[model samples]
Target: MTILLFGITKDIVGSPTLSVPTSSVTGKQVPKTVRELKQFLGDTYPELNKLSSLAVAVNHNYANDDDTINSYDEIALIPPVSGG
Candidate 1:
C-alpha cells in the first residue's frame, strides 16, 4: 500500500510516500483498514503514538474507523496543528 504523509507526518515518515506491505485477501493484496493502519504506523514509528491525536485521509477524503482501504488507494496522515 502507498501512504502519503502530510505536514508533520511527512517528517515522521521522512518522505511524501511510503510503501507498506499488504496481506492477501481472496487473492488480492488489500491494504489495511484505518484502525489497522494506525497500528502499523505505531509499530513502524513509535513516536507518533505519543501524539495527542491524528486524522487519516483516504483518497483525499476523511476516513473513519470502519473504513476499508486498498493498496491502489491513497492514504495520508494528518497530525494536530497549532499556530499563533
Candidate 2:
C-alpha cells in the first residue's frame, strides 16, 4: 500500500509518498488496518511519533483506527498544520 504524505509528514518520511509492505516473501501480512499502519510507520520512522496529530485518510475519507486497508487502497497521511 502507498501512503500519500503531506506537510511535515512528507518531510519526516523523506518523500511525498510511502510504500508499505502488504505481503512478504514468506507470505506474512503487514499493516492490515489503519492503526497497524500507524504503528508500522512509527517503528520505521520514529519522528512520526513526535507529531502532535496525524490523520489517516482512505479513498479521500477520514479513516478510523479499525478501518481496514487493502494493498490497492488509496491512503494518505495528513499532519498537523501551523500558520502565521
Candidate 3:
C-alpha cells in the first residue's frame, strides 16, 4: 500500500509517501482497518503517535476507525494544521 503523507505526517515519516508491503510478501498481518493502519504507522514511526490529531483519507474520503482498507486503496495521512 502507498500512503501519501501531508503536513507533520510527511515530516514524521521523512518522506512524501510511504510504501507498505502486502501480507503475501511480508508474511506479516496487514492492516485491514483504519485503526489498524494508524497502529501500524505509529509503531513504525513513533513520532506519529505524538500528533494530537491525525486524519486518514481513503480514496479521497475521510475514513473512520472501523473503515475497511485494502492494499489497492489510496491512502493519505493528514495532520493537524494551524494558521494565524
Candidate 4:
C-alpha cells in the first residue's frame, strides 16, 4: 500500500509517500484499520511511536479506528498541526 504523509507525519516517515508490504488477509498492501496502520508505522519507523494520537485518512477521507483499508486505495498520515 502507498501511504501519503502530511504535516508532521512526513517527518516521521521521512518521505511524503511510502510503499508498505501487503497484508495476508487482503492480499494487498492496504492497512486493515487506523490502529493497524499505527502498529505498522511503529514497526517500520519506531520513532513515530513517540508521537501522541496520530490521525489517518483513507481515499482522501478521514477514517476511524474501525475503517477497513484497501491496497489500491490512497492513504494519508495526518499528524496534529501546531501553529502560533
Instruction: Output the number of the lDDT-best candidate.
Output: 3
User: Per-residue CA lDDT of candidate 3, range 8-79, in tens?
Assistant: 898888899999876756665789999999998998999999999999999999999999999999999999
Residue 68 error, candidate 3, Å: 0.3
Model 3 has an lDDT value of: 0.92
Give candidate 2 regions above 4 Å deviation: 26-29
Model 3 stretches astray by more than 4 angstroms: 24-27
Q: What is the lDDT of residue 45 in candidate 2?
A: 96
Q: Candidate 2 versus the native: TM-score?
A: 0.90
Q: Residues 8-82, candidate 4, lDDT per residue (tens digit)?
A: 778767788998878566453445777787887787789788877688888888898888887888988888777
lDDT of 3 at 1: 92
Flag the better candidate by TM-score, 2 or 3.
Answer: 3
What's the lDDT of the predicted structure labeled candidate 2?
0.90
Global lDDT of each model? 0.81, 0.90, 0.92, 0.79
**Count of clashing pairs, candidate 3:** 0
* Model 2 per-residue lDDT tens digits across residues 20-64: 877775354588899999998898899999999999999999999
RMSD of each: 3.6, 1.8, 1.2, 3.2
lDDT of 1 by residue, 1-84 (tens): 888877778888789888787766445334468988888788779888987988999998999967998878888888899999
For residue 38, model 2's alpha carbon misses the true position, in angstroms, by 0.2
Clashing pairs in 4: 1-29
